[model samples]
Target: MDQHSDAYFISRVVLFNDQKAFEQLVKRYQKDVRSLLLRLTAGDHHKTDDLAQETFIRAYTYLRSFKAKARFSTWLLRIAYNIFLDSVKKEKRRKNTKLYPHQKSINPESGMDAQLDYTELMKILRPPERAAIHLAYISGMSHGDISKIMACPVGTVKSHISRGKNRIRTYLKLEL
Candidate 1:
């Protein structure tokens, strides 16, 4: 089978509104996007899938506007991150009324239902820190790419990665 580049599929979707091409793009990038959201939500598969679906929807809606300046995956991640922030804000608002049932607890062992089976590094790092580390190490994104996706400066991305690594090292007693 012949493999097509992301740009080719994107062009097909953008110029021709090709649903199959968009589906191909989704299949190509879904794992990374879903994994990013899964870790971001602390292994909430339901929330992750929901957010991933929303992300793809937004991506498809704006597919024609994609400028080809950054990789398609990075653009999708940026959308996913924005969706996550919106969800966080909505949850905060709901929590103020005591309506958000799944509010994370202070205690890791509490019935917050977090999948603590995530790596020690994932469990220890904050959301931004975890995102930076994941984008850099797992997704093989450059610092600039992460900065764009996280909507932060490159320095912030560097700090998140550094702080995340330091915390992980300290937690595991690997720091000198």
Candidate 2:
């Protein structure tokens, strides 16, 4: 589709609350959103799904407010990013409250596999750094795209990626 047609298509779904049009939008963007969420949540499939769902729900709810100053993907990703941060905050509060007594503790030395270690490393990074690295490395977003999604400058995005990568490398004991 041409750029204007695509914008009009998405705008119809937003302005008119067209379910089929929204579904088309979902089919077009769901994979990218889920993949971005998966990386941000450190490959936690369940949390990724939950966050992606929340992201889309939020986007649809706020669709009428969309200014169209940015691409739909960029706008959707900004929503997803907020959802991720909210989820993380909620999880932290839940942990602090000990709401679930039956949760299993993760042991670093249990030979769990590299995936677990990577997950643990992600947990250690600050949210912005983690988001930046995940967008750049895992989702393959350009620095400029990440900047738009993050509402930060491109140079800040690059700095986050560099610092996040360095921290992860140190955590994993990898030479850079």
Candidate 3:
């Protein structure tokens, strides 16, 4: 069976208080959720782990509310995305507050052997663009699926993907 059906089955079990079924669902999706969280947090281990846990916990708590109108993975990812964005906002606020001492000096020697990796540079895109590309390309999600996850129109998702791809091409100087 497809993953959605599997999730539906698990949800039914969990709704009836079946812990084994809940554990099975966790085992199935936890790795994927953690990987998505890791990418969203830019490899921040602590934040990613916390967000992943939160995603699952929230999913479990709301198990009875799932309507099966959307794929389970899509709903779970929406949770992860929201959590990631909240973390980003919190981090931005912390940075603005400057709770830590600021350093004024840049070490010239630090970059002496560090050449710019163009592929890595692509990751510097804004979060929306990065998420659009990652979901459409890496995760193989349809534009419609992304639209639901992002709470935007499908056309907007297409636009984001198009603009994001064009920008990446320009940044990498690659022919599209």
Error of 3 at 46 (Å): 3.9
Give a tens-digit lDDT track for model 1, residues 1-176: 11899988888888899899889889988999999988787678899999999999999999888898888888999999888878877887967643323333234343224433444336566778778988898888899999999999999999999987776655544552
Ranking by TM-score: 1, 2, 3
The digit string of per-residue lDDT tens for model 3 on 10-106 reads 6667667776676677788787778777655555578779999988888888888878889888888888887777767677687874321221122
What tens-digit string does per-residue lDDT give for candidate 2 at 1-176?
Answer: 33345476677776787777777777778998898787677668998898899888888888888888888888999999888877766776878744222222434344324554556566656667878987787778899999999989999999988877776666555675
Error of 2 at 75 (Å): 0.5
- Top-scoring candidate (TM-score): 1
Clashing pairs in 2: none
**What local distance difference test score does each model get?**
0.80, 0.75, 0.69
- The lDDT, on a scale of 0 to 1, for candidate 3 is 0.69
- Identify the runs in model 2 with alpha carbons over 4 angstroms from their true place: 1-5, 97-121
> Residue-pair clashes per candidate, as listed?
0, 0, 0
The number of clashing residue pairs in model 2 is 0
* Clash pairs, model 1 backbone: none
Off by over 4 Å in 1: 97-116, 119-121
